[model samples]
Target: MARVNELKRQLKPGQVYRREDLTPYSNAVDRHLAQLVRDGTLQKLAQGLYYFPKKTAFGTPPPNDETLVRSFLKDKRFLLTSPNSYNTLGVGTTQLYNKRVVYNLKRHEEVTLNGKTFFFHKTPYFPKKATPEFLLVDLVNNLDSLAEEREQILKNILAKAKTMNLAKLEHAVDEYGHSKTKKLFRPVLAEMKKTRHAQ
Candidate 1:
């Protein structure tokens, strides 16, 4: 359990981790992995990623994959800016609303761990990939005002929209069209809707 303890000792909120991170402490992985899940010592966000279990006011309910991933990826390269939030908000959005997370990663791989899955989208094509760390940094740089840079964010998103899966994008906007968040996308979404209609 030393490895698990090391992970418990090191990981902070908002950071995403991989198994290679814990390689030095491999001996304790299996026993502790099973034990952690069993006794609530850890919440596995994916095959190699985990987080300290949450203690909610409701006396500790099971955390979803998103929550676990967010808490574990503490202020690092991987941020929790993904469709997880949209999924949690409801079964509506321009994403799969999939139970797992979808991140814009510097790499590409699919991981299934502790019953949770994560898909890492490559970095080269995303113009407005909003991994929360990058988003927060950009937000901070721009007067800490999300409003000040609203147009830029919207435009960047549309520019990169072509890179995403077209069908899923349509389903998301169609299902969640009435949300106020749509207001941010009104201009681009309108244009997209027009183009979609013409086709």
Candidate 2:
């Protein structure tokens, strides 16, 4: 009991923890974990992941998505995004997606943590955050998976692209665009350049 209390003291509210993190605090780690979970002091998010919910006026809210993911991947270098973000670009994407996408150097699998779906995609490169330019390129890269009219979205994306900074958009395309995305944007960019020269 004394050891369990010691372990409980180590936990901070609203923080995610791995099993190994609590091991050193308790002699009987598994037993203490079971006790803590049964008593609602800790919520087991996944196989080895746990979250200490922070109390609030509304109630105990779930752990932050970034905190949950950072602990799960054990890496800080990742970008969290979703298809729903495409709606912000005004490219006619209106569908609300339940799953979140995580672009990271490690892990490529779909995982459900605390009832939320996360699609972890392995990529060699990704921006630290989802910039508007990156989102546009990402929308095209994942176009096939989105629940929208492909042709209409493509047409709208091209029109939307014309209004953005051509240089930054082109840089995003060169860095993050898939082969098909690059191929699609090439002619559009060339035309924009020609128009600028004509003016």
**Alpha-carbon RMSD of each model:** 13.4, 1.2
Report the Cα lDDT for residue 142, model 2: 94
10 residues in a row with least lDDT, candidate 2: 188-197
Could you estimate the TM-score for every candidate?
A: 0.38, 0.96
Evaluated with TM-score, which candidate comes out highest? 2
Candidate 2 segments whose C-alpha is farther than 4 A from its true place: none
Residue-level lDDT tens digits of model 2 in 22-84: 999999999999999999999999998999999999999999899999999999999999999
CA error at residue 57 for candidate 1, angstroms: 1.3
- List the global CA lDDT of all models: 0.48, 0.94
Give the runs in model 1 whose Cα sits over 4 Å from its true position: 1-17, 25-27, 61-105, 109-119, 127-199
Global Cα lDDT for candidate 1: 0.48
Residue 76 in candidate 1, Cα distance off native in Å: 4.7
Clashing pairs in 2: none
